[model samples]
Target chain A: MLSKTIKTILTISAVTFFLSACSTTSTPDSATGSSTDGSSGTSGSSATTDGSGKNSVNDGVVAPTATVFYFDFDSSVLRTDSRALLDAHAAALKASPRSVRLEGHADERGTREYNIALGERRAQAVRAYLVSRGVTSPIEVVSYGEESPAVDASNEYAWQQNRRVEIK
Target chain B: MKKVMKFSIQVIVASFLFVSALSHAELTISITKGVDNPIVIGIVPFNYTGGGPLSENVAAIVSDDLERSGQFGPIAPENMLSYPSLPQDVVFRDWRLLGSEYLVIGDISPTASGYQLVYSLFDVVSQKTILFNQPIVVARDGLRDMAHHVSDKVYEAITGIRGAFSTEIIYVEHQKKARNYRLMRADMDGARPKVLVTSKQPLLSPSWSPDGQSVAYVSFESGRPAIYIQNLATGQREKMTNFKGLNSAPSWSPDGKKLALVLSKDGNPEIYTLDIATKRFTRVTKHFGIDTEPRWTADGKGIIFTSNRGGKPQIYSVVLADGYPQRLTFEGDYNARAQLTPDGKSIIMVHRRNKVFHIATQELATGTVRILTTETDLDESPSIAPNGASLIYATKRNGKGILASVSLDAGSKFALPSTSGDVREPSWSPYF
Candidate 1:
């Protein structure tokens, strides 16, 4: 049984998942906040706070776009919306020589070691997309698997929040 | 169908949660807390002379060791009629009247460079000394080890099976405060947890070699997960495998010449065996679905692994000659991380029934699956004791990770918990 805080966080995450899942190009300005922040939530909340705001494209540098990308269960194939998000990130990397690390993670289900492979594939897929886009900035990938999660709840919404790749 | 039982355990947070020396807050297992059809016994407090602060008591440690095995029920000191340090002082009638089937007595004395442990095990029924004057020498700081060795000898003399008390266990603790993940080793009684490795990222799936000289585990220290074999004594390590995708779940073969591992380097995850000497690799399973958690059968003829080729994850074994796997589990919709017992008679894995994940055993001959745990949200990673009498696994208690044990037959359960923080990924070490 999930605590009240986790249940509420999952409900909010489910709403956010569906919203982001439907959008084509989730602009960073519009997609900046999700109630499931890293500290209370499982994902990279503290990492995003340190990596964002000043570098966001809408800060008059370029077009603001989403950094974190979500995928379907057990599938590392980048989603259509994630492609658009990655394109913007690739553009940001192309404009500057700044390096970005792709942090990968998976839901807390199945065997941990296998989920590690899944997390690696997810982040490597994002790295492949950025590197293939001719972005000169160095890109790195690290898979946390189900270790550092975004949603503490055990439901599907929470799992979806956990199975994501954060571009840092 | 997954039933969720909600239960809470009081989480006592210790200030020194993370420390360099594992003794900072050793795991204290309450062996006398749970009751079963336990053998009633009495262990007299060990006699000591010229003590330079003996770190542990031999007789008390032996009692705790036997009691924790879930096979022995030790009588409290208050219940004992007399305290005896030798077999001459121990009266059979006195122990018989106290309802103790066996008795233990020991003496410890500090020497110039070490301590001497003299222990004895007696049969209360026949009033005969089973083990007498078992002498052990321990250099100054090795009193705990001497006690465990005595525990080992007494246990074997009475039970006929070699005791695993002197053995060690390797487990991982993933937390926020420390290096995020720590690979640790401790005594079977949950004492002296020494951290072997620490990682900034996640570390999982720690497997020990047959000789207990080294440990091979998956670490993300190089940024991504890769298998590394580290010498336990020298602290020297070598990256065994650093493939492109997945290099995890490394299990050493019984002979120690080969290692069966899970890798996704070729498409999806598959079981592969790596020759330790030649640096050769042999693919064991050919499957489209997720195939992982490959463990060597004790005989070394085949490898048993978990695969989802049949639509749901189940146990399968592949004979090394043909490299063809035969399904061994048909009872449940989900069964993963299957580990064969030392005798090769059964398989222990995380079996899900009605959606509740539990540690279960499947008799290979009968194909009969039996659930070992009753109430828990998620219980997984069932590592069988080297003696095959009990199992230690990671389970969630009050929303935190803790290690729990269960007797294979009696189903008695107990938790070996840390003072604070979550602990998981337990891998029992082989006998040294």
Candidate 2:
């Protein structure tokens, strides 16, 4: 029964996505139109030349696609692979000064409150890295502990995926 | 994208069932293990002389309570040779033939405004009345409470220990499919559950006050984690902490005048005590490592918390006067979420051995360790009963979170499975 319900929900979400896409395409000045082509920087630069200047901040800069950074078990130290992506995020945040929220999470192994503290430590680690990178936008950190899991499983792979901080 | 879709589906389903779930929310208790040689007890069906049937089966409730404690085995009513509601009507030979070592008899008589319960507990072998003609009068809706009272009395009379059957418990139930979280209060046996607070965000670390009139917990209802204290009687809530980084793990002191909680506003997660009235925060631990999960000692003279300053998470106690932390657990590499037993001799905590988490108790003085739960790989948040005979904790069964209880001696065990969703973080209330 649960799987069937999930299937129905997936189908409905797909339909809703398609309908919303159609509605967006029908609008004349839909902001999502330029971003959907994956060449937002080029379109934004042309629009800036057209004197709109609203998209000038993002003219030649590509925002980082990676928002989630994984951590080792019970460790807040960032991985070497996450640095390049975080550098891109720092550049983007510096270019456009928008508030950022860092949500930290942990795997379901230790006690919850301890995990909450661990999650906060992970988020703070990321916040410290971003601040050190000269990104000065307002940064907020929240720890979900193990209460919310990206993948609801108990294996090592799931744990690795769940122990992460999302830059939202 | 998939996560967003799942979350939206959860919100829809939760809103759809919100009304029905409120009216009938409860956790069902299932006894998985009992003592090897449980004491045989016979409970006669209480005679009701009221005009109509009573709302609760007093004798049956009492029987279940005793049996669930794992110390007593109640004989089936069909196996009894006679149903006697009075001490004079109990025949020792009949009960002995039925293999009942002790017997309980009770009856309900109608009163002008409510009902009167008269009960007795007898030792079958000695043919002596242990508790004779104990009368309790209650209003119409308090029959279950009255039955629990009878069970408490009988349990105490036989075991030489105070019974916690009449006490209450608070737990958090999370419906992952619906993204709903509810902080619930219920009888110790998982009956009469009522929602104390509900939110779409997560709630954790529910701590009962020393007076049992209010509860302090961490709620993310306002989009960030903060500590809140809610009066159980008035349903009034006060946001106690709105710190910047983290405000979680609120534990009331033994004196109920202050709350020991974790705050990260200063920098790292550190233990701090907040005066209930003055609202002053006194920093207790000054360490760079993560220091959280602060619990008051029985005397309220020190705070026991989990810290990794020594490299791994271990239980530590910090004296209030000197502010020096003493390590408590050395047997395990992982020990967090510690709670002192009522007598303050032993500490119960989530002990991880061989990468599997289980609830274990360690003596504070002798450093002796006893593992209480061995059946499950993940057991956390163990809350001891006021009498310190048993404890309830959250463990996963078949990938679903459920509340389970085990005796301190590891002789008896039972699981309280929620009817709706996953239940965790059970806080056993103090005796009323």
Compute DockQ for each candidate against the true complex.
0.29, 0.59
What are the per-residue Cα lDDT tens digits for candidate 2 across A1-168? Answer: 235433443445334323322332222233222122111222232322211122434645555544677788888876544554455567677677799999999999999999999999999988887786677999999999998887687777667667889888
DockQ of 1: 0.29
CAPRI quality level assigned to candidate 2 from its DockQ score:
medium
Superposed by TM-score, candidate 2 places the C-alpha of residue B198 at a distance from the truth, in angstroms, of 1.4
Error of 2 at B115 (Å): 1.9
Record all residue pairs in model 1 with backbone atoms less than 3 Å apart, i.e. clashing: A42-A149, A42-A150, A43-A149, A43-A150, B1-B354, B2-B354, B2-B355
Candidate 1 second chain TM = 0.92
lDDT per residue as tens, model 2, B1-432: 011222222322232233223323378766677666667788888999877787777877787788778777677666679999988898899988766789999989988878899999999989999999999998877888888999999999999999998999999999887889999999998888999988999999999898999999999999999899999999999999999988989999999999999999988899999998999999999999999999998888999999999999999999999999999999888999999998989999999888889999999889998899999878999999999999999999998999999999998898889988999999999999
